[model samples]
Target: MAQNAHGGSRPGVQPVALAAAGILLLVGVLGFVPGITTDYAAMRFAGRHSEAMLLGLFQVSVLLNILHLSSGLVGLALARRIAGARAFLAVGGALYLGLWLYGFFIHRGSVANFIPVNDADTWLHLAIGFGMLACGLLISGQVGTGGRLDTPIDRP
Candidate 1:
């Protein structure tokens, strides 16, 4: 397979990043919906003051949803280039790691939980952190494998 716009195979971070971006974008938009985000009226601009929760599970706020939306946009923009894809993954990993840290230290019901993260969101952040890092690291090496490893038929 020829290199795509990102100078890598079509199965690289381009697809995964795009998917992630889309999902995050949808989640961000949905967070603003009344029923989807319970107690929408109480949604604070920032801080743990917001009682709104996305899907009535994960804590959320206006600032948090907007941040998610912006991150998704960035991810979409970077999905077309190998370098940009790698950068996006790396940055995403760092952001998730930061979120993990924030989740660990912030008071769940206090103003510290500006992101409105909860246990579920914390774990999800951890997963995103590791997954993004792995994607960037693992894919960097496979970009030019030349299909040699998969050519069993040519191993006469």
Candidate 2:
């Protein structure tokens, strides 16, 4: 097997993790853009009062964007190895699930919603959480040596 820059086998790299990381990084960066993130001038450091919305859908703040960027960075760093990538997805997915549930208890436009999630964000979190978890559990070893999905084409 060919080794990558991270000293891991090229096939060990997880595509799902990379895609997740890329998405997060893109979203994070987009949050800072004025047009992409509406009400850019109203974005708060970390609070529900922030009026900024990414793609005019999901509410965003400086802190939330930072969190996304950080998560994406972690995913990228971990994607070099199969085990590390799976751990990242599993743990990150759980955290997103927790965030999703947390959004339920938070009242709209209340200080308690420091994470500043709206209904759109809440449902999106559910989808994202489930997706990440499924990818972690079911897709974990697909890219690694003799992975569960791997079958020798030369075999009779």
Candidate 3:
């Protein structure tokens, strides 16, 4: 197996990062599609005034879509290395958690709602945050002999 610069074979971390990146990229693209994003014409560059909702559920603005695209690109770039992939998942997860909290606390239509996150977005952020964090911490390890030790299931 090819070893990454981190001196370990690329294991579960890369795939998790790639999956997350692909989702982000797909979401960003979907946000721009007319039927997929309801009230498409009402989409604004940024701010709570944007009336667009992805799948008629999550509020989305042009700025939010761009952020998703950027995050996907970053994930793709970082997935090249084991350490980078771990960092992407962990740090990205933390950021998503923070976004969830921000969305939950901020009143809609307020200046603080610049990201314009809705209830759907808030809950989705929570899920993504915990999911990413779990993937980052639980899945990381070297492949083969250098990886985590596995115990026999039948061992008492």
Candidate 4:
């Protein structure tokens, strides 16, 4: 299937990167909504004190939502190119994995939970982390037999 702005003859990261970015944007926006995010009023700039939970599942805060929004925007921008997309995924994935590891040390109600990550957020971060990293690592091989594996390339 021919996809992406440059057409289908290239190993594009549109599907995975775009999808991931879109989800992040959606989650970020939803987190701000009152009903969607339970206890929306409790969301704080940064701290475990924020009781806001996105979709009544993952705990969220102003800081968390902002982070999501920012990351999603960056992902969208980077997805325009294979190199950028791969970098976005790889770097972002590593950061998320780091966040996951940090979650282990930050207790549920500890003051150190500045990001206010809970069990749900923690696990989800782990999933996104590995998923992004895997996508980045494997995206290069997505181009079929005739596709150009390099960026800034135009097949004649």
Candidate 5:
């Protein structure tokens, strides 16, 4: 098995976690940028009143950006271990799925829509949930007992 810089024998899960973390970090940072996030001045700390759109697509606020940044940081920290990476993916996926449902069911202008999620954000959340869940489950097979990398089974 190939060893990663962290000395982990399983390289698959770590890379996935790292990539996801990097993307989250980038999106979070872009939300604060003027051009990247349109109507930057209109961004609120939280709630439906925020008019800021990240990449002119998904709605965002200071709270949402902070969530993304924190999630990214957590992902980066968890990527050091296979179990931690798997947990991050699984738990993160579930959280996104829950958020998607909340956005889908909640009225857009209602106070319950505290995240102020739009249609695009809801759909993106759905995709991210499935993608993360799939990655976590698929990669888990490569993890052996005691959290070590499992050798591929030989075929006749």
Candidate 6:
């Protein structure tokens, strides 16, 4: 496997992906906590009316937290392989971007707002989409051009 300019032996993307997953999981869990998520009782499954916020900044709900956690896990799991990581980032980014679009179109107070995203969340999702995709695509692997895979072609 190729080594970075540094002496590390593993690909850089895996660590970042795993870290993102961990952070997402933490955020999801925290959103459920009363103190952490202020106005716990007012939290709803979805919609703009939900008074709960993650870090008192981003709007959140039970469904939204679950989705965030799940997406993070998927990103970490997919990071085990280069191709999988790439696909996860690309697809995940697209999904988030789509979610941002959905947030824009959906009426915040309507029943259709399942994710409970607000204006802040819509912007955040857009950032996540671009960031995740960029990280996956830009991170160099531990091995040669083909990534960390140990194949005959990569063993120069």
The per-prediction CA RMSD against the true structure, in angstroms, equals 6.1, 6.5, 6.3, 5.4, 5.3, 4.3
Measured by C-alpha RMSD in angstroms, how accurate is candidate 2?
6.5
Give lDDT for model 1: 0.78
- What does candidate 5's lDDT look like per residue over 43-121, in tens digits? 9999999999999999999998998898889999998888888888889888888888998999999998887899999
**26-95 in candidate 4: lDDT tens per residue?**
9889989999999888889899889898989998989899999999999999988768888888898998
- Candidate 2 local lDDT, 1-156, one digit each (tens): 444447786433388888888998998899999999999999999898899999999999999899889999999999888888898888889888888998877898777899889999889888888888878887636544654443598567
Instruction: Residues 1-156, candidate 1: write the lDDT tens digits.
Output: 337556765565567777777877898899899998898998988887788888988788888899889988998999878678778877887887888888988878885666778887788788878888777655642444344233478676
Which has the greatest lDDT?
3
**Candidate 3 stretches greater than 4 Å from native:** 1-11, 144-146, 149-156
- In candidate 4, clashing pairs total 0
Q: What range of 10 consecutive residues in model 6 has the weakest lDDT sum?
A: 141-150
Q: What local distance difference test score does each model get?
A: 0.78, 0.84, 0.87, 0.83, 0.85, 0.78
Residues 78-149, candidate 3: write the lDDT tens digits: 988888888889899998899999999999979989988999999999998888888888774464325454
Distance (Å) between predicted and true CA of 49, model 6? Answer: 3.2
Better structure of 1 and 5 per TM-score: 5
lDDT of 6 by residue, 47-153 (tens): 66788987788889888988988988888788777677777777787888899899889898888887788888899888888877787777665444554545698
Off by over 4 Å in 5: 1-11, 141-156
Model 5: what TM-score? 0.84
Model 4's TM-score against the true structure: 0.84
Show the colliding residue pairs in model 3.
none
Query: What TM value does model 1 have?
Result: 0.79
lDDT for residue 119 in candidate 1, whole number 0-100:
89
